[model samples]
Target: MEFILDTVDLEEIKDGIDHMPISGVTSNPSIVKKTSPEDFFGHMRKIREIIGKDRSLHIQVISLEADTIVEEAHRILKEIDDQVYIKVPVSYEGLKAIKMLKAEGIHVTATAVYDLMQAYFALAAGADYIAPYVNRIGNLGSDPMELIGNLQDRIDDDGYDCKIVAASFKGVEQIKNAFNYGAEAVTAPYAVLKQVFANPNIDKAVTDFNQDWYSVYGEGKGICDL
Candidate 1:
Protein backbone atom coordinates (compact mmCIF):
# COMPACT_ATOMS: atom_id res chain seq x y z
CA MET A 1 0.00 0.00 0.00
CA GLU A 2 1.11 3.54 -0.78
CA PHE A 3 0.68 6.58 1.43
CA ILE A 4 0.29 9.80 -0.53
CA LEU A 5 0.11 13.29 0.88
CA ASP A 6 -2.89 15.35 -0.24
CA THR A 7 -1.45 18.79 0.53
CA VAL A 8 0.82 21.19 -1.37
CA ASP A 9 2.65 22.63 1.63
CA LEU A 10 6.39 22.13 1.25
CA GLU A 11 7.15 21.73 4.97
CA GLU A 12 4.38 19.13 5.35
CA ILE A 13 5.61 17.33 2.28
CA LYS A 14 9.09 17.12 3.77
CA ASP A 15 7.72 15.87 7.06
CA GLY A 16 5.56 13.26 5.37
CA ILE A 17 8.50 12.01 3.35
CA ASP A 18 10.72 11.85 6.40
CA HIS A 19 8.21 10.27 8.77
CA MET A 20 6.07 8.12 6.53
CA PRO A 21 6.38 5.98 3.42
CA ILE A 22 5.04 8.76 1.22
CA SER A 23 4.63 7.56 -2.36
CA GLY A 24 3.42 10.80 -3.93
CA VAL A 25 1.92 14.25 -3.47
CA THR A 26 -1.57 15.32 -4.61
CA SER A 27 -3.10 18.78 -4.75
CA ASN A 28 -6.45 20.28 -5.69
CA PRO A 29 -7.52 23.90 -6.13
CA SER A 30 -8.73 24.01 -2.55
CA ILE A 31 -5.41 22.66 -1.27
CA VAL A 32 -3.57 25.26 -3.34
CA LYS A 33 -5.80 27.98 -1.91
CA LYS A 34 -4.70 26.92 1.56
CA THR A 35 -1.02 27.39 0.71
CA SER A 36 -1.59 30.46 -1.52
CA PRO A 37 1.78 30.25 -3.24
CA GLU A 38 3.00 33.45 -4.87
CA ASP A 39 4.58 31.62 -7.83
CA PHE A 40 2.42 28.71 -8.88
CA PHE A 41 4.71 26.92 -11.32
CA GLY A 42 7.81 27.89 -9.40
CA HIS A 43 6.32 26.48 -6.20
CA MET A 44 5.44 23.26 -7.98
CA ARG A 45 8.96 23.02 -9.29
CA LYS A 46 10.26 23.49 -5.76
CA ILE A 47 8.04 20.60 -4.64
CA ARG A 48 9.48 18.45 -7.41
CA GLU A 49 12.94 19.34 -6.21
CA ILE A 50 12.16 18.19 -2.66
CA ILE A 51 10.30 14.98 -3.57
CA GLY A 52 12.65 14.23 -6.45
CA LYS A 53 11.62 12.45 -9.66
CA ASP A 54 11.14 9.01 -8.11
CA ARG A 55 7.85 9.82 -6.35
CA SER A 56 4.75 10.95 -8.24
CA LEU A 57 3.31 14.49 -8.17
CA HIS A 58 -0.34 15.05 -9.02
CA ILE A 59 -1.80 18.46 -9.85
CA GLN A 60 -5.42 19.24 -10.66
CA VAL A 61 -6.60 21.35 -13.55
CA ILE A 62 -8.99 24.22 -12.84
CA SER A 63 -10.73 24.17 -16.21
CA LEU A 64 -14.16 22.55 -16.41
CA GLU A 65 -14.40 22.08 -20.16
CA ALA A 66 -12.73 19.16 -21.92
CA ASP A 67 -10.68 21.19 -24.38
CA THR A 68 -9.52 23.66 -21.72
CA ILE A 69 -8.75 20.88 -19.30
CA VAL A 70 -6.60 19.17 -21.89
CA GLU A 71 -4.92 22.45 -22.66
CA GLU A 72 -4.29 23.09 -18.97
CA ALA A 73 -2.83 19.61 -18.60
CA HIS A 74 -0.30 20.30 -21.33
CA ARG A 75 0.47 23.71 -19.82
CA ILE A 76 1.01 22.17 -16.41
CA LEU A 77 3.29 19.54 -17.94
CA LYS A 78 5.32 22.28 -19.60
CA GLU A 79 5.38 24.40 -16.45
CA ILE A 80 6.14 21.52 -14.12
CA ASP A 81 7.81 18.30 -15.22
CA ASP A 82 6.18 16.00 -17.74
CA GLN A 83 6.22 13.16 -15.20
CA VAL A 84 3.56 14.94 -13.13
CA TYR A 85 0.20 13.19 -13.10
CA ILE A 86 -2.60 15.38 -14.40
CA LYS A 87 -5.55 15.14 -12.03
CA VAL A 88 -8.92 15.46 -13.76
CA PRO A 89 -12.27 15.38 -12.07
CA VAL A 90 -14.50 12.48 -13.08
CA SER A 91 -17.09 14.65 -14.76
CA TYR A 92 -18.50 14.32 -18.27
CA GLU A 93 -16.01 16.85 -19.60
CA GLY A 94 -13.21 15.59 -17.42
CA LEU A 95 -13.62 12.05 -18.74
CA LYS A 96 -13.24 13.38 -22.26
CA ALA A 97 -10.06 15.14 -21.19
CA ILE A 98 -8.77 11.95 -19.60
CA LYS A 99 -9.38 9.97 -22.78
CA MET A 100 -7.58 12.52 -24.91
CA LEU A 101 -4.62 12.77 -22.53
CA LYS A 102 -4.36 8.99 -22.25
CA ALA A 103 -4.33 8.77 -26.03
CA GLU A 104 -1.29 11.05 -25.98
CA GLY A 105 0.35 8.82 -23.27
CA ILE A 106 0.03 11.41 -20.50
CA HIS A 107 -0.26 10.18 -16.90
CA VAL A 108 -3.79 10.92 -15.58
CA THR A 109 -5.51 10.58 -12.24
CA ALA A 110 -9.28 10.63 -11.98
CA THR A 111 -10.51 12.76 -9.05
CA ALA A 112 -13.80 13.99 -7.54
CA VAL A 113 -15.36 10.58 -7.92
CA TYR A 114 -18.40 9.95 -5.73
CA ASP A 115 -20.19 7.20 -7.60
CA LEU A 116 -18.99 3.75 -8.62
CA MET A 117 -19.95 4.42 -12.22
CA GLN A 118 -17.76 7.55 -12.28
CA ALA A 119 -14.79 5.44 -11.18
CA TYR A 120 -15.62 2.85 -13.82
CA PHE A 121 -15.68 5.63 -16.38
CA ALA A 122 -12.24 6.78 -15.38
CA LEU A 123 -10.93 3.23 -15.45
CA ALA A 124 -12.41 2.77 -18.90
CA ALA A 125 -10.85 6.10 -19.89
CA GLY A 126 -7.48 4.63 -18.81
CA ALA A 127 -6.71 6.74 -15.77
CA ASP A 128 -3.74 5.59 -13.71
CA TYR A 129 -5.49 6.26 -10.43
CA ILE A 130 -9.12 6.75 -9.31
CA ALA A 131 -9.63 8.81 -6.15
CA PRO A 132 -12.88 8.26 -4.29
CA TYR A 133 -13.94 10.89 -1.74
CA VAL A 134 -14.19 8.58 1.25
CA ASN A 135 -15.33 10.85 4.08
CA ARG A 136 -17.55 12.87 1.81
CA ILE A 137 -19.23 9.69 0.62
CA GLY A 138 -19.67 8.54 4.21
CA ASN A 139 -21.08 11.95 5.16
CA LEU A 140 -23.56 11.51 2.33
CA GLY A 141 -24.73 8.31 4.11
CA SER A 142 -23.07 5.88 1.74
CA ASP A 143 -20.67 3.14 2.80
CA PRO A 144 -17.29 4.14 1.43
CA MET A 145 -15.68 0.80 2.32
CA GLU A 146 -18.25 -1.11 0.31
CA LEU A 147 -17.70 1.21 -2.61
CA ILE A 148 -13.93 0.73 -2.41
CA GLY A 149 -14.35 -3.02 -2.04
CA ASN A 150 -16.58 -3.24 -5.09
CA LEU A 151 -14.14 -1.14 -7.12
CA GLN A 152 -11.26 -3.38 -6.05
CA ASP A 153 -13.22 -6.42 -7.16
CA ARG A 154 -13.89 -4.86 -10.52
CA ILE A 155 -10.24 -3.95 -10.98
CA ASP A 156 -9.01 -7.43 -10.06
CA ASP A 157 -11.59 -9.11 -12.28
CA ASP A 158 -10.77 -6.94 -15.29
CA GLY A 159 -6.98 -6.90 -14.69
CA TYR A 160 -6.87 -3.13 -15.16
CA ASP A 161 -3.60 -1.35 -14.50
CA CYS A 162 -5.57 1.34 -12.65
CA LYS A 163 -5.13 1.67 -8.87
CA ILE A 164 -7.65 2.85 -6.29
CA VAL A 165 -6.15 5.86 -4.55
CA ALA A 166 -8.78 6.71 -1.96
CA ALA A 167 -8.98 10.40 -0.98
CA SER A 168 -10.85 12.97 1.21
CA PHE A 169 -10.16 11.38 4.56
CA LYS A 170 -11.26 12.97 7.87
CA GLY A 171 -9.52 10.75 10.44
CA VAL A 172 -6.88 8.05 10.86
CA GLU A 173 -9.43 5.25 11.07
CA GLN A 174 -10.80 6.27 7.69
CA ILE A 175 -7.31 5.89 6.26
CA LYS A 176 -6.96 2.40 7.75
CA ASN A 177 -10.44 1.50 6.56
CA ALA A 178 -9.63 2.63 3.06
CA PHE A 179 -6.60 0.33 2.94
CA ASN A 180 -8.52 -2.50 4.59
CA TYR A 181 -11.17 -2.14 1.93
CA GLY A 182 -8.58 -2.71 -0.84
CA ALA A 183 -7.33 0.75 -1.71
CA GLU A 184 -3.87 0.43 -3.22
CA ALA A 185 -3.09 3.92 -2.00
CA VAL A 186 -4.68 6.57 0.21
CA THR A 187 -3.89 10.28 -0.02
CA ALA A 188 -4.47 12.23 3.18
CA PRO A 189 -3.30 15.34 5.00
CA TYR A 190 0.10 14.94 6.68
CA ALA A 191 -1.44 15.69 10.06
CA VAL A 192 -4.08 13.00 9.52
CA LEU A 193 -1.49 10.38 8.54
CA LYS A 194 0.79 11.34 11.43
CA GLN A 195 -2.10 10.79 13.82
CA VAL A 196 -1.36 7.08 13.53
CA PHE A 197 1.34 7.64 16.14
CA ALA A 198 -0.80 9.91 18.34
CA ASN A 199 -2.06 7.30 20.77
CA PRO A 200 -0.94 7.75 24.37
CA ASN A 201 -0.79 4.02 24.91
CA ILE A 202 1.89 3.66 22.25
CA ASP A 203 3.99 6.36 23.86
CA LYS A 204 3.47 4.82 27.30
CA ALA A 205 4.48 1.42 26.04
CA VAL A 206 7.68 2.80 24.57
CA THR A 207 8.43 4.67 27.77
CA ASP A 208 7.91 1.53 29.84
CA PHE A 209 10.23 -0.51 27.63
CA ASN A 210 12.92 2.16 27.74
CA GLN A 211 12.63 2.53 31.50
CA ASP A 212 13.06 -1.20 32.00
CA TRP A 213 16.06 -1.29 29.69
CA TYR A 214 17.69 1.64 31.49
CA SER A 215 17.02 0.15 34.88
CA VAL A 216 19.07 -2.92 34.01
CA TYR A 217 21.70 -1.27 31.77
CA GLY A 218 22.27 1.77 34.04
CA GLU A 219 21.29 4.63 31.72
CA GLY A 220 22.16 5.27 28.03
CA LYS A 221 23.70 1.83 27.63
CA GLY A 222 21.57 0.39 24.89
CA ILE A 223 22.22 -2.75 22.87
CA CYS A 224 24.19 -0.65 20.40
CA ASP A 225 26.53 0.50 23.19
CA LEU A 226 27.20 -3.10 24.20
Candidate 2:
Protein backbone atom coordinates (compact mmCIF):
# COMPACT_ATOMS: atom_id res chain seq x y z
CA MET A 1 0.00 0.00 0.00
CA GLU A 2 1.19 3.52 -0.80
CA PHE A 3 1.38 5.96 2.12
CA ILE A 4 0.04 9.53 1.95
CA LEU A 5 0.71 11.97 4.73
CA ASP A 6 -2.53 13.44 6.15
CA THR A 7 -1.44 16.95 7.07
CA VAL A 8 -1.85 20.59 6.06
CA ASP A 9 1.40 21.92 7.44
CA LEU A 10 3.52 21.94 4.33
CA GLU A 11 6.72 22.74 6.22
CA GLU A 12 6.23 19.91 8.70
CA ILE A 13 5.36 17.46 5.96
CA LYS A 14 8.16 18.55 3.62
CA ASP A 15 10.68 18.48 6.42
CA GLY A 16 9.80 14.88 7.17
CA ILE A 17 8.99 13.57 3.68
CA ASP A 18 12.52 12.56 2.73
CA HIS A 19 12.60 10.02 5.57
CA MET A 20 8.86 9.39 6.17
CA PRO A 21 8.45 6.56 3.62
CA ILE A 22 5.38 8.27 2.16
CA SER A 23 4.41 8.76 -1.47
CA GLY A 24 2.22 11.87 -1.21
CA VAL A 25 0.19 14.20 1.01
CA THR A 26 -3.55 14.72 1.67
CA SER A 27 -5.34 17.77 3.08
CA ASN A 28 -9.01 18.66 3.53
CA PRO A 29 -10.62 21.87 4.75
CA SER A 30 -10.48 20.53 8.29
CA ILE A 31 -6.76 19.90 8.18
CA VAL A 32 -6.25 23.23 6.44
CA LYS A 33 -8.21 25.03 9.13
CA LYS A 34 -6.10 23.41 11.81
CA THR A 35 -2.96 24.70 10.13
CA SER A 36 -4.22 28.27 9.92
CA PRO A 37 -7.69 29.41 10.89
CA GLU A 38 -7.72 32.36 8.50
CA ASP A 39 -5.48 31.71 5.49
CA PHE A 40 -6.05 28.44 3.66
CA PHE A 41 -5.33 29.74 0.19
CA GLY A 42 -2.07 31.25 1.35
CA HIS A 43 -1.13 27.97 2.99
CA MET A 44 -1.92 26.16 -0.26
CA ARG A 45 0.37 28.46 -2.20
CA LYS A 46 3.17 27.66 0.22
CA ILE A 47 2.41 23.98 -0.15
CA ARG A 48 2.67 24.13 -3.93
CA GLU A 49 6.03 25.85 -3.64
CA ILE A 50 7.35 23.33 -1.13
CA ILE A 51 6.25 20.28 -3.13
CA GLY A 52 7.29 21.79 -6.51
CA LYS A 53 5.29 21.48 -9.74
CA ASP A 54 5.49 17.76 -10.49
CA ARG A 55 4.87 16.34 -7.02
CA SER A 56 1.40 15.09 -6.06
CA LEU A 57 -0.88 17.07 -3.78
CA HIS A 58 -4.49 16.42 -2.76
CA ILE A 59 -6.68 19.43 -1.93
CA GLN A 60 -10.39 19.24 -1.15
CA VAL A 61 -12.80 21.69 -2.71
CA ILE A 62 -15.32 23.33 -0.40
CA SER A 63 -18.04 24.18 -2.88
CA LEU A 64 -21.33 22.26 -2.83
CA GLU A 65 -22.42 23.52 -6.27
CA ALA A 66 -21.18 21.69 -9.33
CA ASP A 67 -20.28 24.88 -11.15
CA THR A 68 -18.42 26.28 -8.17
CA ILE A 69 -16.57 23.03 -7.55
CA VAL A 70 -15.62 22.82 -11.21
CA GLU A 71 -14.32 26.36 -11.15
CA GLU A 72 -12.40 25.70 -7.96
CA ALA A 73 -10.85 22.58 -9.38
CA HIS A 74 -9.47 24.43 -12.37
CA ARG A 75 -8.14 27.24 -10.22
CA ILE A 76 -6.37 24.85 -7.83
CA LEU A 77 -4.94 22.77 -10.65
CA LYS A 78 -3.73 25.88 -12.45
CA GLU A 79 -1.50 26.42 -9.43
CA ILE A 80 0.70 23.60 -10.70
CA ASP A 81 -0.16 20.77 -13.10
CA ASP A 82 -1.85 17.36 -13.38
CA GLN A 83 -0.11 16.17 -10.23
CA VAL A 84 -2.72 18.17 -8.28
CA TYR A 85 -5.76 16.14 -7.18
CA ILE A 86 -9.06 17.87 -6.41
CA LYS A 87 -11.16 16.18 -3.74
CA VAL A 88 -14.93 16.35 -4.19
CA PRO A 89 -17.70 14.75 -2.16
CA VAL A 90 -20.01 12.01 -3.52
CA SER A 91 -23.13 14.15 -3.78
CA TYR A 92 -25.01 14.73 -7.03
CA GLU A 93 -23.25 18.05 -7.47
CA GLY A 94 -19.91 16.45 -6.67
CA LEU A 95 -20.52 13.67 -9.20
CA LYS A 96 -21.27 16.16 -11.90
CA ALA A 97 -18.27 18.25 -10.98
CA ILE A 98 -15.99 15.22 -10.86
CA LYS A 99 -17.18 13.99 -14.25
CA MET A 100 -16.59 17.37 -15.78
CA LEU A 101 -13.15 17.63 -14.22
CA LYS A 102 -12.26 14.11 -15.32
CA ALA A 103 -13.41 14.82 -18.84
CA GLU A 104 -11.00 17.71 -18.90
CA GLY A 105 -8.33 15.27 -17.60
CA ILE A 106 -8.19 16.56 -14.03
CA HIS A 107 -7.53 14.05 -11.26
CA VAL A 108 -10.54 13.85 -8.95
CA THR A 109 -10.88 12.15 -5.59
CA ALA A 110 -14.48 11.38 -4.58
CA THR A 111 -14.61 11.74 -0.84
CA ALA A 112 -17.23 11.39 1.93
CA VAL A 113 -18.12 7.86 0.90
CA TYR A 114 -19.55 5.51 3.58
CA ASP A 115 -20.78 2.44 1.74
CA LEU A 116 -19.72 -0.08 -0.89
CA MET A 117 -22.36 1.12 -3.37
CA GLN A 118 -21.22 4.71 -2.95
CA ALA A 119 -17.68 3.76 -3.90
CA TYR A 120 -18.92 1.85 -6.94
CA PHE A 121 -20.99 4.82 -7.98
CA ALA A 122 -18.04 7.20 -7.70
CA LEU A 123 -15.97 4.99 -10.00
CA ALA A 124 -18.94 4.88 -12.35
CA ALA A 125 -18.82 8.69 -12.30
CA GLY A 126 -15.21 8.46 -13.49
CA ALA A 127 -13.44 9.55 -10.35
CA ASP A 128 -9.72 8.81 -10.34
CA TYR A 129 -9.86 7.89 -6.65
CA ILE A 130 -12.52 7.06 -4.03
CA ALA A 131 -11.89 7.74 -0.35
CA PRO A 132 -13.86 5.62 2.13
CA TYR A 133 -13.40 6.64 5.73
CA VAL A 134 -12.62 3.65 7.97
CA ASN A 135 -13.10 5.42 11.34
CA ARG A 136 -16.53 6.66 10.32
CA ILE A 137 -17.69 3.22 9.29
CA GLY A 138 -16.28 1.65 12.46
CA ASN A 139 -17.97 4.31 14.63
CA LEU A 140 -21.33 3.02 13.36
CA GLY A 141 -20.43 -0.46 14.61
CA SER A 142 -20.16 -1.83 11.09
CA ASP A 143 -17.57 -4.13 9.56
CA PRO A 144 -15.23 -1.83 7.62
CA MET A 145 -12.97 -4.72 6.60
CA GLU A 146 -15.89 -6.37 4.88
CA LEU A 147 -16.55 -3.23 2.89
CA ILE A 148 -12.85 -2.93 2.02
CA GLY A 149 -12.74 -6.53 0.85
CA ASN A 150 -15.88 -6.16 -1.22
CA LEU A 151 -14.71 -2.95 -2.88
CA GLN A 152 -11.25 -4.32 -3.57
CA ASP A 153 -12.59 -7.37 -5.39
CA ARG A 154 -15.24 -5.38 -7.21
CA ILE A 155 -12.73 -2.85 -8.53
CA ASP A 156 -10.18 -5.48 -9.47
CA ASP A 157 -12.71 -7.68 -11.24
CA ASP A 158 -14.11 -4.76 -13.22
CA GLY A 159 -10.59 -3.50 -14.02
CA TYR A 160 -11.48 0.08 -13.23
CA ASP A 161 -8.61 2.58 -13.30
CA CYS A 162 -10.18 4.21 -10.28
CA LYS A 163 -8.49 3.37 -6.98
CA ILE A 164 -9.60 2.98 -3.35
CA VAL A 165 -8.00 5.39 -0.83
CA ALA A 166 -8.55 4.26 2.74
CA ALA A 167 -9.14 7.48 4.73
CA SER A 168 -9.62 8.58 8.33
CA PHE A 169 -7.54 5.74 9.68
CA LYS A 170 -7.71 5.31 13.49
CA GLY A 171 -4.69 3.15 14.23
CA VAL A 172 -2.09 0.73 12.89
CA GLU A 173 -4.65 -2.10 12.97
CA GLN A 174 -6.97 -0.13 10.69
CA ILE A 175 -4.05 0.67 8.37
CA LYS A 176 -3.08 -3.01 8.29
CA ASN A 177 -6.69 -4.01 7.63
CA ALA A 178 -6.87 -1.77 4.57
CA PHE A 179 -3.42 -2.88 3.38
CA ASN A 180 -4.30 -6.58 3.77
CA TYR A 181 -7.22 -5.99 1.41
CA GLY A 182 -4.92 -4.22 -1.09
CA ALA A 183 -6.02 -0.63 -0.80
CA GLU A 184 -4.31 1.47 -3.44
CA ALA A 185 -3.43 4.19 -0.95
CA VAL A 186 -3.85 5.13 2.70
CA THR A 187 -4.21 8.73 4.04
CA ALA A 188 -3.64 8.74 7.77
CA PRO A 189 -2.65 11.35 10.33
CA TYR A 190 0.95 11.97 11.45
CA ALA A 191 0.07 10.36 14.77
CA VAL A 192 -1.22 7.21 13.11
CA LEU A 193 1.74 6.91 10.73
CA LYS A 194 4.16 7.57 13.57
CA GLN A 195 2.40 4.95 15.67
CA VAL A 196 3.13 2.22 13.12
CA PHE A 197 6.69 1.94 14.42
CA ALA A 198 5.59 1.41 17.99
CA ASN A 199 5.23 -2.19 19.06
CA PRO A 200 6.67 -3.58 22.28
CA ASN A 201 9.54 -5.20 20.44
CA ILE A 202 10.14 -2.12 18.33
CA ASP A 203 10.16 0.06 21.42
CA LYS A 204 12.61 -2.22 23.18
CA ALA A 205 14.89 -2.16 20.15
CA VAL A 206 14.75 1.62 19.98
CA THR A 207 15.54 1.99 23.66
CA ASP A 208 18.50 -0.34 23.36
CA PHE A 209 19.74 1.36 20.17
CA ASN A 210 19.56 4.87 21.67
CA GLN A 211 21.70 3.81 24.60
CA ASP A 212 24.26 2.10 22.38
CA TRP A 213 24.26 4.66 19.55
CA TYR A 214 25.68 7.70 21.47
CA SER A 215 28.64 5.55 22.57
CA VAL A 216 29.26 4.40 19.00
CA TYR A 217 28.60 7.59 17.04
CA GLY A 218 27.70 10.25 19.61
CA GLU A 219 24.25 10.78 18.02
CA GLY A 220 21.24 9.08 16.45
CA LYS A 221 19.83 9.85 13.02
CA GLY A 222 17.42 12.32 14.67
CA ILE A 223 14.55 10.58 12.94
CA CYS A 224 11.19 10.22 14.66
CA ASP A 225 11.09 6.43 14.92
CA LEU A 226 7.86 6.43 16.93
Best by lDDT: 1
In model 1, where do residues sit more than 4 Å from their true spots? 224-226
The residue-by-residue lDDT of candidate 2 on 1-226, one tens digit each, is 6788889876668765766867777899888777774666667777777766655689999999999999888888776455788999998888889888888888888898888888888888888888999999999888777888888888889888977889988789999888888788888888788786667998899789887866665565444532
lDDT of each: 0.95, 0.82
Q: For candidate 1, give the lDDT of residue 86.
A: 98
TM-score of every model versus the real structure? 0.97, 0.86
| RMSD (Cα, Å) of model 1 | 1.0
Predicted candidate 1 versus true structure: per-residue lDDT over 68-129, tens digit per residue: 99999999999998999999999999999999999999999999999999999999999999
Total clashes for model 1 = 0
Q: Which ten residues in a row have the lowest lDDT in candidate 1?
A: 217-226
